[model samples]
Target: MPKAYVFTRYGGPETEAFVDVDRPSPGPGQLLVAVHAAGVNPVDWKQRTGYRRPGESDERVFPVVFGNEVSGVVEDIGDGVEGFAVGDAVFGTALAGGYTEYTLVPAAIAAHKPAELSHTAAATLPVAAATAYDGVRQLDLPSGATLLVTGAGGGVGAAAVQIARAFGLRVVGVASEGKKAFVESLGAEHVASGPGWAERARASAPDAVYDLVGGQVLAEAAELLTDRTKLITAGAPEEEVRRLGGARVARARNAAVLEEVARLVLKGDLDPHLTETFPLDRAGDALRTVEEGHARGKTVIEVTR
Candidate 1:
């Protein structure tokens, strides 16, 4: 049996409970990982509180595991799985079922963890990294283009800043004044406010723009972009993104982009900013930290030794 966090009812972090369950086995083309750390994301709380996707029915409603990204050593490999063996260290976002002592991951989605990163650091990469990579690619901005990132000190924003810089684009990151230095350290010129942040960004780079904040800032950015410039949002409200004339991205599509992100991390071009970690029993605390929305970077749940 393995310990896992499960929620029987929709509510805040308080509703989550850790319980013992039979260990899961990998099916064909899958690898069983002894989870060491799991990343906590906003989606975890959005789903738990039934806030983001209201009125939508979750097939895995009760007794659900909420984590997405997991980092660990492979304990077993199912028949037909190739290119992986037991004892391989790996990290990836599980489609579901990651906040457990063990998880089964599709071989195609799992990648070797970067040697430079610890399990805790690698655990922070998949979801945010993938979203950042896809957002950068969708924008397709040219070298020396000025890019604007909203929520620029958060997990996705920090990753976007680094990825955009790696692509040769100059970035202006919009964050709170408290986060200004943090954003600047990621290679972005810092603008210290959320609302009308794009306008301030235009002062530095008027030619190209990227809106990571979807509500008013995205709408404001839409006015500044020419047909040659592109606007893309990840981890922002989808309807507001469309209203702002920007494209909204799906998490699965972002997951597909993780392959590139994994390579970048291995090559030392991308870094995941992990700010805090809690044990699996303290998963509720982990969720609360992210819900506060002032975290400097990613928060994660450590599931095992």
Candidate 2:
């Protein structure tokens, strides 16, 4: 049996618990991994409260493990899986969940970890970095064009700013005043988030907007882009964004996207910015930091062997 953090049923932290369960076996096209690190994101907490993506109707079987991405070594290969072997270091979107000592990863979305990148850094990529990459590419703004990024201090936002900059686009990053320096360090002009933040961002004369914060913030960002197609969000539902004449970030969840982001990391154009890490026993605290919306960068759970 393996110990995993899980939510017994959808509700709140009270529904969550530590339970011992049989280790997951890889299915067809999947690989069993010995997880070394798991990335914590807002979605992990949101799911505990019954949040699901648009069209996601698969009923959750409790006690569901908690996590979406991880980096680790391969333990076993599933039927029909090729290009990977036992002991190969890998990282990807977890098929089951990632917060346990072992989990399954779909080979289609997983990539080999380069020796230079640490497990902590690779763990943050499949969701946050990959989402950022997709949204930025979706905008397709020209070089020297200004791209305004909302919620620019969190995991995905930080990655978006850097990737946009790497693609030769100028960036305007909106975040709390507390994160101004951190956002600026990512090569974006920091716009303090609050009343009149969008007005202040107008000074940058953005050609596109990459939104990670939904609701009113997204509506405000929408107003800044006259070419609505250039406005994209990983934050809001597609209908909401499309009604505003924008679109949601279309994810290309494949190993190709994972490899591209890894290349960006190796080329010095992106950093996962793993700002905090906790041991497996403290996974709840790590989730809370992101759920509270105060995390300055990516948070990870470092599972010690």
Candidate 3:
């Protein structure tokens, strides 16, 4: 039996627990991975509170494990799988859950972990990095265009700033005053978040806004652009974005995108910015770091075998 951190039901941290469970077996087109590290995101806590993504099913079994992305070694391959094998290093969005000793990942979305990239770095890519890649590419702004990134201190925003810079675009990054240097280090003109932040951002005269903070922030960002079609958000719902004449990040959930992000990491264009890490037993602390909104960058859960 393997141990996993799970939320017994839809609720608060009270529902989360560490329990012994059978190791997951790979189904058709899935691969069983011995998880080395898992990325922590706000969605993990939101999911525990019963927040479901668009098109996600309402039905869920109790004691569901908590995680979305992972990096590890392949332990077994399922039927109809290709381009992978046992002992191969791999990372992807988890099919079961990532906060465990072993989990299943679909072959279509999984990618090989390059030798130079560590598992911790690879774990952060599948969700945050991939989302940034998709949204930036979706905007399709040309070189020299100014792109404004809200929540630029977090995992996805940091990646977006770097990726935009790599593509020869000018960047304006909005984050808290505390993250001024962090945001500036990523090659963006830093904007301090708070009252009148949007008004301050107006000077950049951004061609597009890549929003990671939704609600009022998304609404405010929308007002900056004359062409609302250039506005996109990963934090807000599609309906909310569309109401503002914008759209949600259209994810191309495939291994090809994963490989591209990995290449960016290797090329020194993007950094996962892993600010903190916790072992599997302290998974609660890891979740709290992100949930409390205090994390400067990405946080990871390292599983010790």
Question: What are the per-residue Cα lDDT tens digits for candidate 1 across 215-283?
Answer: 666667677776533667764566666666666654454334666787787777887777888988888
- A best-first ranking of the candidates according to their TM-score comes to 3, 2, 1
Candidate 2 per-residue lDDT, tens place, 31-93, comes to 999999999998899889998877788999999999999999999999999999999999999
Clash pairs for candidate 3 = none
lDDT of 3: 0.95
For model 2, give the RMSD to the true fold: 0.9
TM-score of each candidate structure, all chains considered together = 0.88, 0.98, 0.98
lDDT, residue 128, model 2: 96
- Which of candidates 1 and 3 reaches a greater TM-score? 3
Q: Candidate 3, residue 102: CA error in Å?
A: 0.6
The positional error of residue 285 in candidate 1, measured at the CA in angstroms, is: 1.4
lDDT against true structure, model 1: 0.78
lDDT of 3 at 237: 82
